[model samples]
Target: MGRGWRGAAARRTCNPRGPCCRVAGDARRPSRPRLSRSLSRRLTVPETLPSVPWRGPRHGRRVGTDPRRGPQRRRFVTLAALLALTVSALSASAPFDLASSGSDVAVEVPDPAPVATPEPEPEVEAPLVVPAATPVRVLIPAIGVDAPIEVYTDAMVAAADGWIDPTTHDVVSWWQGGGTPSSDPDNTVYLYGHVSRLEAVFNYLHSVVPGTEVTVVTEAGEIVYVVQEVLEPVGKEALPDDPRINAQVPGRLVLIGCYREPDQGRRRTTHNIVVIAHQVDSAK
Candidate 1:
């Protein structure tokens, strides 16, 4: 009996089916066949399983894989992509310092100081007063009328050698010359007298023709005029309206007189003869 019991103990140790053996008596040993059968069944099934609905991290549910580690790997991949894009963009842009390439560089520069311009001065005009000329000598060769001309006032005329007509009663009205007191140096010097009545005065003035010579002495100098034109017309219609006639261009003289008629009474009635002459040369 003792030997049989010892043999049974030894067989329990070697035999995997022994009842009292530790390895054979393990409770998980019964599931070994089930694990092998499950593995065989998994091999026969499809490799892919039906997908599960995913929820965000706020929920306590966990992903089959580690959720934190998956998002970290995706973020690392996105960062790598962004870094690559930034490097490519920086390489495509233009470089600075283009002046060394012989091309013009646009840079702002300030302007220099401006120059000042000068204004013109205003003009000054002369005063408005009648200018007086110095009296020179008068010459009338025909009737021995050569004499010195003076500013003959009424007192001077009464005491002068020449006599004025009693009818006209005018001393300055007899021998006329010079312009209005308002005229300038270039004004006309007109002379006039009665031809029919004054027998010694302007009776020979009618005989004067073109190229006739007449002499005048002025304070400035002596000037001689040659007859240029003779005009005869009745009444005021004979006068020329041109103001240039008043403009005594350098040396000019105009002589005026009334025509004579033996039948006409003392009551004056005749046409006026105007002779225009220009200076040829100065009498030295």
Candidate 2:
């Protein structure tokens, strides 16, 4: 519609450095310089943009000389330059580096104060052992029994089914293969006496209870044992198999006896009773 104006499209860019716009080419005042023919064909840019007065470098950074500020060139920096500045600031305030200061820094590593390692504890010696003497007689005041204890080896016991012979009605049979009353194989000395309802020794063994005191004489002196428990009656077959009867006993005295009723009223041989006793002290 005008003599000097040109229009090829609705929207276009005049140039990157200038005001690119749309729909209003003539909206620009004629007081400013005009756009070039080539740029006008490419973009619809305003002929004049708003201007700002430019100041020089801001805090050591460059500013544009375009006499304006709105389109000032942005400032940027590289990693090397930023890192150099950070290191310089840190070096001014940080403690001095010993490595950089070298030998004159006298970085003395103290000789670790002599660790007083305690002298190794001296080795100890073992106590000398004296074998216990053979046991002799046994005395149980609770049951009025003070019988002679005769040596009865396992062989002798086998002949009597691990019991005191019926003929020896008043004596106690000490199991000989077992260790002495004070020595190890658990110090278990098995002793059993004949029990007749009428006259045999240990006839009252079943009546004994816990805490009964029994004393035995050994050639070494006298050893006293206190009854710890009175176990329930065990059958003759099971009695032979008991761990305590077969030399597997712990360090305690095991007294065994049978219940014999006179004349088969309730059968003469009933289940055997065992009285377990533990030695409390010794008298030399």
lDDT, candidates in the order shown: 0.54, 0.73
Residue 182 of model 2 has an lDDT of: 61
How would you encode candidate 2's per-residue C-alpha lDDT over 146-238 as one tens digit per residue? 888888777876887655563488888887877577633255777878876568888899899999999888776777789988978788778
**Candidate 2 collision pairs:** 12-43, 12-44, 13-43
- Candidate 1 stretches with Cα past 4 Å from truth are 1-135, 140-185, 237-250
Per-residue lDDT of candidate 1, residues 1-284 (tens digit) = 99976565445345557655454344456645445776888779787989988875585556655667687888999999999887566555525343354433445557887877777777855443334344355465643445444343445346544332223211113133344222244556565444655444455676777887766555655556678876654343434454435455544667666665567677765466567877566554
lDDT of 2 at 23: 49
What is the TM-score (0 to 1) of candidate 2?
Answer: 0.49
lDDT of 2: 0.73
In candidate 1, the residue pairs with backbone N, CA or C atoms under 3 Å apart (3 or more residues apart, or in different chains) clash, namely none
The backbone clash count of each candidate, in order, is: 0, 3
